[model samples]
Target chain A: MDIVLGQLFTGLSIGSILLLVALGLAIIYGSMGVINLAHGEFVMLGAYSTWLLQSAFGLPFLACLVLVFFMVAFAGWVVERGVVRFLYYRPLDTILATWGIGIILQQAVRLSAGAELRYVQTPEALAGSIDLLGIAIPSYRLFILAVTAGLLLLTWFLVQHTEFGMKLRAVTQNREMASCYGINSSRVFSLTFAFGSGLAGLAGALVAPIKSVAPDMGTNFVVDAFMVVVVGGVGSLLGTVASSGILGGSTAGLAFLLNDTLAKALVFLAVVVLIRFRPRGLFVDRVRR
Target chain B: MSRIKSPSHAWPPANSSAPPAAARPSLPQRASYVQILVYLAFCLLILAVPLVIDDAFLLNKYARYLALGLAAAALSLSWGYSGILNLGQGVSFGLGAYAIAMHLKLKTSPVHTGAAGLPDFMVWNNVQTLPWFWEPFHSTLFAILAGMLLPVIVASLLGWFMFRARIVGVYVAIITLAMLVVTNLLFIDQQRYTGGFNGLTDLAWLEIGGVEFDPYSPTFYYLTAGCLSVCLLLGLALTRSKAGLILRAIRNDVDRVRFFGYDVAAYQILAFAVSAGMAGVAGMLYAMVLEFASPTFMGVPLSLSMVIWAAVGGRGSLLGATIGAILVNFMQGSLSETFLDTWQLILGALFILVVLFLPNGLASLIDMAGERLGRAPPRARTEEPAAAAPRAMGTFNTKQRG
Candidate 1:
């Protein structure tokens, strides 16, 4: 019972991070039909933003997080306007183009940060451990879960309940119909794209404290996030959440019992098997293939 | 050269809805055995490059390219003709590499010192004994067999699931990319057995029963060249067979194939398996030449470069893919060595040029010139055109689906 509880906690903490990463992916891919292969790179940028504010300006980490969100969000907006907007209609092309953009971004970061991992200190308030019932768990993991949950609620409220949320949902369902109804889809796409990217940036900032910030570090996460996207299902939020839970818990939990390679292979085999049955994802949709 | 087969056939089509367009030209029936000999002669002349370079380093470089050429040919079999765009083919190649690395690691490690147990990396990473998985790899014959069979089994299963489920395009690519990542990470984390990031090494020369041939000896070069030749022959036979045509049909029109009562996934799995086996052959050759195998052989950068090689060469043309692999690799080697700082910028610019302009690939350049040459003189018109890119003219024959 204790081991199971411990495993579940670890899984929950990991799943929270995946949620932040996949939220942006789901929004952009689901609504706009753009994969944004460079989404992981945006997270890297957010982490870098945190680093810059800390090292360059000597700002506090918590304060820097908020400022970096807006700053990174604005950067995302500009990128959407400049490049990604042109690619919304072409999914495969966008994947290739953004992959090119990712390489360029990685190289640029390498030039700027000198091709090595940088250390980031977690805030003092979030440091140390706390007793969760009878078991002791790291406060940082608990903090991440809290912050991510809060952000998720905030994002869900904004999307599901607000006027803009209605507008965004309207555009995603039927672009031509929404436009015929005078919904201004272009504005919605741009706004949602920027908005989703900001979430990625935030995820990056959160991850920075746990993992070292490096130019090439983003490459590793980029592919795993793709797995999360597939396991979850493209264009489905519920699908992503379910898969993230299954994947995170399974991978980490399996790693505890088995060698890491076999664990990963098992996850891959699971995805392969799931894909065989569902094809689209673990979720079903009317659109075949 | 044929004066616009139809006025409506022009690209971007003067208009979008142009009556579905006409079929492209049929396969040219001009290659006699005489022309075939000339083509072979040209390829052989190019193969004679090592005689002139005379530098052991340079000969080895070309030899390595030849080995890579075999891998590229296998890749083209699946991606170019089959249109599966299997982005995780590198995983199959890596499986072969790891197999050889295991045998070599066990053979040369100082701790084990004998060729019968776990590698030193496994020992250092605190593996108490040889894992059960390592048991199958103890025999040289079984190790090689498993290397090939593992990828085949995995690919077939993956293909059966994916194709049967109708996963196509970006979704398929994304799933495969995820596979690559998960595989690489798994390799990295299994520090105890797989050597993690550092990977397995310290392999000595290989010999088979009373043969004292050193791995890096001239005999090895001939061996690799011979292996490449055998792979090429196998590829040619596969591509020329009825099954190959069916594979191409599946690529161009899976819906049509299903409509005609064909099991598309079966063919797909077969092509993927053949390619996987070829990759294994390439791996065996690579291990023999380098005398060491590491995770780097199956790394993402290496895998991506092969994709670029196949694409830039003209995925449709086997010769073009081989040429692309050699040329791009050679250019990268020389450019990185000479420019150091600006090589990436140069490569990026090259990628853009290739994507935007030569989208059909470098092989298309020859065709473009050949078309121009068709009008040059009466003398040139009689000289047959080289197979520029294997144009599956039947692909657009939508009626065949009936």
Candidate 2:
């Protein structure tokens, strides 16, 4: 039972990272009608940015995190303006184009960093383990939980209770209607894409301390994120959170019992089955059309 | 002739293709019989090159290209004709290749030195005997059947779900990519059976009917060429059929085809199954040719590159896919061997260029130029034949395929 409880906490920690990645994907897909295969690249860039700031500039962790997000978010805006704006009507082309950009970015990173795995040090505040009852839990894992929860709150506030959030949601639901009402959908699109990419970047910075910081690190995370999006329901951020918990927890719990790769496969199969049964996912807005 | 003289001269300006429309004398609606014969002869010559090349290395290397060509043709059949963009074809290829890899690996096991045995990889992973899954693959006939049927069945199921949900565009692409990743992880983790990251390797020659089936032998080359021709013929025949034309129409406008009383889902699923089966056949040949199968075969990059080859060859032209795959493979092989670590950058740049500049693909360049030179007014001679007409660049402007 103690081992079970330990595995449960581990699941929550893994779920925290997945929540960050999948929320970014969900918001972007909602706003831009793009399944950005390169979204992972943003996360990757964030990690690299964090590494550069800390290692080269000798910045503190909090300052480095902020810089990484801003840097990658700016890159995301440029990508939206340059490559993705031409592809709104052709979603599949956008998928391919972003995939191309991802390959290029990954290769560029590989060239710069070499293929070897790099490491990022967590701050002294978040280091070491915490004893809970009879089980010893990692403090960093608990810190991730706090950070993820805080961000989820921040994301919800920005999307639901703010004027800019209203405009973004209005445009997503009906671009023509929103535009007719004097909202600039294109600007909204760019902002949302950038915001989503920035969030992904933040995820990378946060995860690099724990996970291996490598050029292709996004490849592993993106698969899990895609599964989260599909199982949660594309364009539904709330469902994304719910699905990530389900998938992430189950996957981590299984990994404790089985191999990590096997657990990943099992999660994927479960999601495929879930999507098969509930095409719109467990929670979706009721549509009159 | 009078109708042609006025309209053909005046057409490129209004159409806005900005292409070779201004260069050539207008081709007759009916191609001369000799032109057809010449093309057939050119194709014959291409076949003979593989045959007459005395160097076994060159002959067999191109045989591998022929395998990819077959896979590309399969992609065009589903994605180009049916408008399905079935991204899981590589998954099927990997599935088939893995099947044969398992068979070959099992056949050569040291455990089999004294008795019928499991694969060496399986044994290395601590299996004393063949696993339940390995049972059917032990027989050559059953392994082939499993290889072909497994992909078709899996694709059929996937197609049923996706088409039924009316998922199109990026959604289907995501679903398929999801499948590819899931399947790869499953295979990689089932290390007891699949051999994990090291994959199934060190494959031996296939033997049948008391004949030694050396992978490098000319007999395999002939067999590969025969299979390529057969797959190509089947793809062409399907495209030329009434069903193929309907599939193409669905690609253009799904709603209009639905209005025509066709079951759009059925056509798409059928096409997906057919294409998946073709990929499986190519995968089988690839396993035989390369004597190896690994997870990379089904990687997302590979799945995307197959689409790249089809697009670069001009998806509308069936013959172009064969040429595209072979040419692309040749360039990839030569460039990678020469440039080593830098080929990916070039390949990515090439992919981007093809999408942006020649959306109709390289094969369409000749067609565009021929029409412009043959039919355009003499006043347009100063214009480049390929770029004289205005270009169409949008999803709505997706060019027709053969």
Candidate 3:
């Protein structure tokens, strides 16, 4: 019973991390229809930002999180304006272009940061673990969960009830109609892209303490995030949430049963099989043309 | 169609005059003449390299470049002609490498093998006998056949699933990328069977009919060059075929092609499988060239590099992509020696520039120059308009269509 509860806690922690990383991908791909391959680079930049702040400037982890969000968001905005804007009409070309951008960003990070792993110290307040139902859950894991939940709600509200969300949805559905109604579709795309990148950055900052922060760390994260978005359904927030949980829980459970590597392979196989059945993903939005 | 009359022609006085079909045929014939001249020139250049360069080391290096060029040409067949961006091409390449490497590894002397003739890594992992999968690889013929067939089977299955579900464009790229990660992990994790990260090294030279093909020997170079030429010619023939025309049509507007009663998925699967087979052949040759197989062959960098090679050469043209792979790789080999850390940065920047300003790549530049020199109106080539306006994958609601 204790083992089961402990595994469940581990599963939730894993699920929260997946959701955090995938949220931005889901938004950008769903709204703009641009497959931002450099998104992982945004996450990498966020981690590097956190490390620089905590080590160089002696800033607190919480403060770094807030600042890293905007910094990475600005970087994403520049990428969109500079390169991605031109390739919007040629969506397939965007994949190759963004991959080039990802390569550039990764190399740039490697050159600037000296190709070594950078570590961030966890907050002193959240260093301890708390006993809950015979399972000792780390306070940092709990903090990540809280942050993910808060961000999920924030993203939900922003996309559902806010004017920006309305503009984004309108642009997604019918760009000409949205433009006719005085909604600047390009600006909306730019902002949504920035926000999505910021979320990825936050994810990077949050995971910095737990995972080794390196220039190439984003590759694996990006793949996982892609899987989450793909399985969750492209643009559906609820789908993203549910799929992350399903993937994370299965990963944890499978790892416990077999091994870590096999668990990953099994999860990938499962996702591929699932996609074979549900091409649009689990929670597809029924939007009429 | 507007016809430009010659300055000698009295056009206003000839109401019953028919259009000059004889002149029309000559224009295209002249274009093909130029194309044949270029093709023969390329073939001659490849064949003459051994005579020009006496250095065994340089010949070996050039041979590897040719192998990579073959892979790029294979990529062009699917990506350029069929419009499928397979980011996980390295998976097929690596699998083919491993298949041949296993055979060569088994043929090595007892120094590298433990008691009972098990591979050293397997001995270290406490395996007394050879695994079942490794058994068939002992036969050189079986290994070579498997090297090509394995990737074809895997790619066919993957393409079948993807196209059946109607997954197109960027989604195909993403799924392939994901598969690369999975395959890489699997290869690395199965340390006991796969020799882990160190991969299969210390391979014996492949021998056939009393002749041994050493990596640094001229014979091996010729073998690689011969295979590459065959693959390129095959690829060129494929692109010029009727099915290839249909594939290009599918790339432009899949829905329209479907409406015309074409089984779009079947064509996609065919191009994908053929591409994978070519990559597999390249992989087999690469393994022979390098004398080992490592997991890094399936790495993201190598796979992406293959794409860059195709794009830079002209993904729309098979021969162009082949030349591009060779040129880029040759330049990379020399430039990295000087610039080291900055080489990737330069490559990335170049890739972006090509994708943005020169979408058809360096080949199109040559084509443009040829058209200018010929003083003929640009012919309606298959790749030009396809590159200009690519159809979005089926699922997305692209604004271009509406």
Best by TM-score: 3
- Which stretches in model 2 have alpha-carbon errors above 4 Å? A286-289, B1-46, B109-116, B132-139, B208-213, B336-338, B375-402
Ranking 1 against 2 by DockQ, winner? 2
Candidate 2 fnat reads 0.28
Top lDDT hit? 3
Residue A94 of candidate 2: its Cα lDDT?
62
Instruction: Sort by DockQ, best first.
Output: 3, 2, 1
Candidate 3 yields a Cα-based lDDT of: 0.84
DockQ class, candidate 2: acceptable
The reply for model 1, stretches above 4 Å from the true place, is: A1-5, A70-90, A161-167, A176-190, A259-262, A284-289, B1-27, B31-46, B105-119, B122-150, B181-196, B208-219, B336-342, B345-358, B372-402
Query: Candidates' lDDT values, in order?
Result: 0.69, 0.75, 0.84
Please state the error at residue B259 of candidate 3 in Å: 2.9
The candidate, 1 or 2, that scores higher on lDDT is: 2
Task: Report the C-alpha lDDT of model 2 over B102-175, residue by residue, as the tens digit.
Answer: 77776774644334466666656777877788777768887787778888999999999888766665456657
Local lDDT at B193 for model 3: 95
Interface RMSD, candidates in the order listed: 9.9, 11.4, 10.5
